[model samples]
Target: MVGLNRLSLIATLGAVSAQFQKPLLSQLDDVLLETDKTGDKPLVDTESLQAHISTESLFEHANALYELAKSSEQEFGHPTRVIGSEGHRRTLEYVAAKIDSLGDYYKSSTQAFPAVMGQVFQSRLVLGHSVPESASPMSLTPPTTGKEPVYGNLVLVDNEGCGASDYPDKLKGEIAFIKRGTCPFGTKSDFAGRAGAIAAVVFNSNPDGLSGTLGTPTPYHVPTFGLSGKDAEPIVEKLKAGEVVDSIAFIDSVVNTINTTNIIAQTVEGDQENCVMLGAHSDSVGEGPGINDDGSGSLTLLEVATHLTKFSVKNCVRFAWWAGEEEGLLGSDYYVASLPEEENKKIRLFMDYDMMGSPNFAYQVYNATNVANPTGSEQLRNLYVDWYESKGLNYTFIPFDGRSDYDAFIRNGIPGGGIATGAEGIKTEEEEAMFGGKAGDWYDPCYHQLCDDVGNVNATAWLVNTQLVAHSVATFAASFEGFPERETTKAAGVYEKDTLYHGRYLVR
Candidate 1:
């Protein structure tokens, strides 16, 4: 019986040697055998055990964790702000509790929510006739209230044919009908506002489409709304008939006090000096529950932290679940900007996981152009590619587009990279053939919308990507070489272009 047990151990050791060349696994085997001889369970050698854990097994575990997170999202429903009127604090508490259950490796930090909200603009439009359906409130525009709906006749103000001052006085108490051309929308709107016009409806002149915001937040005293080109032609025709048209307008809605929080957790070990940072946002837009939008990435980070705690990595790994990402990357930007110089410099590399689990999703790599460029680092990009290829997984290089949390890191000149599943944009026929997704469809239809629930994700794709991230993380943490220190610069230059791609400057 003893000989058989010894033989089994020998086979396991031999397999480890044949599979991996790293010395850590051999050290782990010695510890395991010593425990067997002493009639006690031996301490697992983290480095060595990591080598033996097959990629398939790691992916399986990662998939299980993804499903678990998805279930939690369903059970918890949408997590809005807790302390704020939105009720998202419960979600923060729930996330903290989950990290706590994983034991002592996680720590939580409570940050004060900053005050930032959509700006409210007052828009008033008087028309020649009652066209209620033709005029609905824009999505981000606030509603208005007043003593009376400001009424006026629709006057077609052609800014080019007529002078800029040829409005309002000609049709006071009547709508100013304007052709959409020549001037900026905001400029036309401002001109109309000064002329005492109740509202200005700008229609598209071209066939393609005219969709844009009214520049920055403008405080127009009168309510304003954009009219689609198709909807405005008939109204303009009627006004041109020299008919008197009167319409009322008001926009008095408050867009204030939306709140969000950032969730941070640190590992248990205090002695680990070097650090690896992993992050993903936890909040979605007011659209869907964002299960796949970011829940996939967030959960993957959680599972990686959970498994890594079981194995002792030499460096400290910080896991961040950021909030207000959909609100224009507010949370991450705040956190990075707040980090002290020393701590910021210690962040060797930032691995951002935004949307990693889209089914039929394209695999992309960031920071891959011009390996010799000073703005980006080829070393980190090559490290990621090598790790993925070693595991026999497919991946593609994607240029940094300033679309995710990595933007904050790159702005600070830190080496940043991440994986993303496609979103909003269509995958071309060629891309579809290579990636096996339907062409002419968005990578994610529910992006920033209310339909981004659990059903929106491809479970199989999510599983594979999550596992790939885990493997990449483990490899980078274990064996990445360090870069020489460079002097920091204070100029507001493009960090990604100069430092990330060219390896030139660091933001001070």
Candidate 2:
């Protein structure tokens, strides 16, 4: 029950509740608007909530989550805190416990999902049918292994190997050398394999011979190698010269079925019809602890939710710690699909945060207000813009192109927006001048690698982004009156996946 004194104070003031000092009360009255139609829950505007948010509190919460992930890694002896792993399980429990400690102010629960989890991968391309040389693995359909390398004669498959006719009958029991082009690596590789080649080698379309992704997985393709064009030309020329040389191509990877849960928590006292949803992925990639990839995001939300209990909310604020995001945004997708129509309709807007703190950082705000955005998305974008402008910080806009978990919500027409530092994307000199990071370097050089542990986070970046998260949540929970109404129809031309991503991040 709420304190009798607090109720009496609100009754007397007509719009206040917290044990505020004179200055805070004066500040609250100036901004907190009148109650909604029910008049049972009054507004607790952004200013009042921002007053409670401290950089110190954010770091405390962030460090807490990092410690949990590190503990999970040390305890489990695994390189990552991926979904269904022991560390991931403990991390989920920690988040649940934090939510529970809010004393029933927020109702919390776990939503579970079963997924075909792909773990680590190992690949090799042997030379002279003996010692193997280094080669990159393509994203889609990494070969299932334990089969010995196929020592096949090499065949030059030109025209991007996009068609069966691209590979001649002479390709039987041979390794098809294809060029990357308009189609996906998976398609090219699959076509070559179907044409009777035992293996496929995709050389670069660019001068440097950049590695490529198959885009999606397929069972038809055999072991594939993504080699630079430079590294592959000699062999190609040799094969063309009718030099009878045999090569061995091999790959080893693991695919397993795993169970994980998405943690959902919401304010018990707010209006159920107009819910404000916020989320971040809780699972990490297999290569590292993923502290920056998402621990920064999930913990930031946790801190906001924990502090929110100190005040009242007019609209419900729901928090989610999604699992299996690194793999394919699986947990968020599952949750969205499971919601009843009415339940889905209740979600007014969703704001997501992923990879908000990279050691080499720049602020990246989602372009949710732009073309193809859902209704109310613009308001969320404006909120961040207004917030950043207030601080005189420069932030770049990243396309809301379904690169993250928000895809599931927005595709169903729920308006959403969020912040990110960056992933594997390279930073420009312009960004360097604005945010002071190295130009031409990846925003997160350690992204998806073994170094993305607690040490990978940029402290200043995390705090600033997290504080903005608090301000946004407080603004909506107070009243979403200024935001536009949401449309129930599925969004048209929503962010679709590239053939390579397929709604999941291509963990290159």
Candidate 3:
């Protein structure tokens, strides 16, 4: 009844608005004419689509997304486009508006679902009398707020706190101070708890404040918090010098189910049975405005989709702005699971784009040539490799370690590949020589932090990756000439689960 009433209301509003405005269908003809380079609509080609990608348009959309995320904090008290937040809703609206502007050229809709999300309202870490402003709680870690804040003398854990031996006997009934590296956050938290520590504080190896996770909830975990390198340095020094550092760690976090939507759009003029899909997670972590982590990828797809409106395609091209990615790739996982088997066969390939403009960037393509990759994945990988080699650009291979939106596709026997600049992984001296970025620094220092704002992105790297994305979309949409067919059963491949969960990369 509510749905019917909403539809009726929409109809009434449409009728009222029709009096002052031209019908959308009527305006589409004029829009089409404006988009056409020739007098007639030409078959979509690689060069024509590539020509449409511009730094001006990319940044224009990027800036809009960034501003929307910023405004979300003021309007809704959430500083990010996290799933189910108003910021995410506004982001969906932005994408929908862009698709709507195409006016019948594409079909679009929102895929709504419920997800359990852990929201941290407050995470405070106090060392002696000094409180660190960069302190935050790891998502899914046990919370200590509302109860007495865990108070104890801090014991510096030797090494990276991945092993039980690292937690000294002195950690018993104390707070364990450990550096963030080698194994998942959960590993350290569990070790700290087992060592009888009241709480665990993990500091980043990089200068940025760490916004991370324990992968998932565990009974062995204790209240855990993160601190930036600079903030933790003094505490570390005091503890190493055999000085007793009194500390308090508090976290107020809760997990609850919330409704979220994924925005999906596809061309109407192509063979739907053979579709080429491209996706990027639209949701951000709860830490900050996720403009670069995925805003770059999401906006890149949006810009490409806008340009594709000017031409026709042989295979349908679908663009998805996925939600709930930071909360364990929930949106894409749901999408793939809910898709019917016959509809699943329609997807020729899946390409994902995430964090394209990391400050210290690299041209890293998915390593689909590895034995663990599903059938047809290698060919898709070759497209990116060939594109880079053709342009005489330096490139490297990134593992398909179930890190991004591509996880669902490959697990379902669908061939998938994409590109990323880099994330929390440190840049080596070799990468420094190749990419001309600082060695021993994070590719994205602001990865999953409050600093992942407008200034965090590298515009030059973003533009290059955006063009590469456009090139792939045009190539597959034109023809899947050399692409292999997906198998009937789930693809046989070992998905190497890396220590990198979401944007946080653990050393192990």
Candidate 4:
């Protein structure tokens, strides 16, 4: 199949005609000849794939993907490719078409899963007689507007309403005013719900305007809203002054369950039982185009996948672009959960590429080999370290807390490793010394904002990371001699680890 060119097909036809003693080619009504139009492109393998990857090719593909995102925005009216949106659907289609084009080299497959489309909420929190203001609803916030507002005596709870014990008995039938920190939103909501609270308000401890997803959906909580600590401080002071602090929370939201896709493809060669998987989130946050956030990651995978068609691999190299990573790794979680235990065992490693092209970048690798310390993670760690060392480039390890799509893979005990440039986190002076960028600036100043469009991309970071990704793909595709293989699983369910759902912040 590697050498199945047009001339070879013609030669095959001649042989068939000679064997049958008839001119089968002449009798055929429709043309049946297919060709390896790749011409002299090297057959796909570690060395060949590495050799074929060029900056120009990767940049061209990146530009096209950015254009696709812009086109989706122009057509869909949403700035982002959030799951189930026009941008996202079109993005998947674009990637799928590219994968299909490589049908000659790989066996493409998709794992369809149900996703809860993000909710539409018209919510307000009316404190006392003040007119209601737009309350930042937690991500995956449930709808609750039953013709009557939720009325309760709002009482104060400790900072980081992290545990049930934090809610006093007075919270029964009252609204719990908790501060956000230390725990997932679900934990706070669950504690408040169990304490008989009718609603929960989680105000941020930081001055930064508070608003984010509830991590994931939960059934044990009432309607919850997040507030900026700056806005809520006055209320906390009022309550501390022995005020009653009456409040009403109203939430009207419509939820939809949508069918989304995960794009997957693997080389036709190599052992099926052992696979090296590279993944990136194809969807973006609701905030903006997210070109640098993940457009960089997805396009990197696309360019690598495209070049992979040039040569054959020794071990199967599988490429995946997940749909809903911004919504707390939904696509990856579903894909990993749906796999049978036997099939799950087939994955040797999962390496993620996300936000690798942050404008103010740091070459960060997931610290899976250390803190998370899953099996065989060190090999992946060394791959990046050695590569960076050879280039005299600085690289550091970010905690592998499953803040991205790798959450699902590591939960199932797959040895997970990956790289990220940076996100909303500020880059410090120490980092500046190593990576040589300005100190005290956001790694991606436009992390999830409207400006995260094509113009926001860091071309140098994108090119460097894409090449490294290609090298990893090629290295793993060639052999797993030093990589760790997965251990047998005892049970198959929603695999849970202590991985932080969104950030490295732990919740217990």
Q: TM-score each candidate.
A: 0.65, 0.82, 0.73, 0.81
What is each predicted model's overall lDDT from 0 to 1? 0.58, 0.76, 0.82, 0.75
Best by lDDT: 3
Backbone clash total for model 2 is 2
lDDT value, candidate 3, whole model? 0.82
Which lDDT tens digits does candidate 4 get at residues 381-475? 88899998988889988877668888777777777788989987889888999987778999988887878987777778888888889889888
Residues 213-327 of candidate 2 have per-residue lDDT tens digits of: 4544566776677777667767777877888767777777655667889999988878899999999999887677787888889888887887787677878999999998877
lDDT of 1 at 27: 60
C-alpha lDDT (0 to 100) for residue 452 of candidate 3? 88
Rank candidates by lDDT, best first: 3, 2, 4, 1
* Model 1 lDDT tens row, 1-508: 2234544656666655555634655665566564533224222233333444343543453344334344334433543221232324455665677788887655667555673444334444445444544453333333443523555556788653134565647755445666656444555655666676666555666433343333323555234566666777767677678765666666654445455678887755522445668788766544345666676677677666666655545456678887766545667878878887777766666778887756557766675442422233565677667766876766777667656777777677566677777776677787786678888888777665545655667766666666666665665455444543322522224453432111100110
**Where is the poorest 10-residue window by lDDT in model 3?**
1-10
Instruction: Show model 4 residue runs off by greater than 4 Å.
Output: 1-47, 70-78, 119-135, 143-151, 157-173, 179-183, 191-196, 203-212, 215-220, 227-242, 248-253, 490-499, 503-508
lDDT for each residue of candidate 3 in 1-508, tens digit (9 for 90 to 100): 2123333434555555666445653554455543434324667877778888888888888788887887678655656887767788889889999889989889998999887678676677889999989887877766783645778998899999988999999888899999988687888999999999989989988888886777656667888887899999888888888888898887777767788988999988778899999999898888888889889899999999999988878789999999988888878988988988888889988999988899999899989753566688898899999999998899999887778989888777788889999988899999999999999999999998878888888988998888899899989888888788756745324344443544332322
Q: Counting only residues 3 or more apart in sequence or on different chains, how many pairs clash (N, Cα, C under 3 Å) in candidate 4?
A: 7
The weakest ten consecutive residues by lDDT in model 4 span 28-37
How far in Å is the alpha carbon of 206 misplaced in model 4? 7.4
- Predicted structure 1: lDDT: 0.58
User: How does candidate 1 fare on TM-score?
Assistant: 0.65
Evaluate residue 210 in candidate 2 and report its C-alpha lDDT on the 0 to 100 scale: 50
lDDT of 4: 0.75
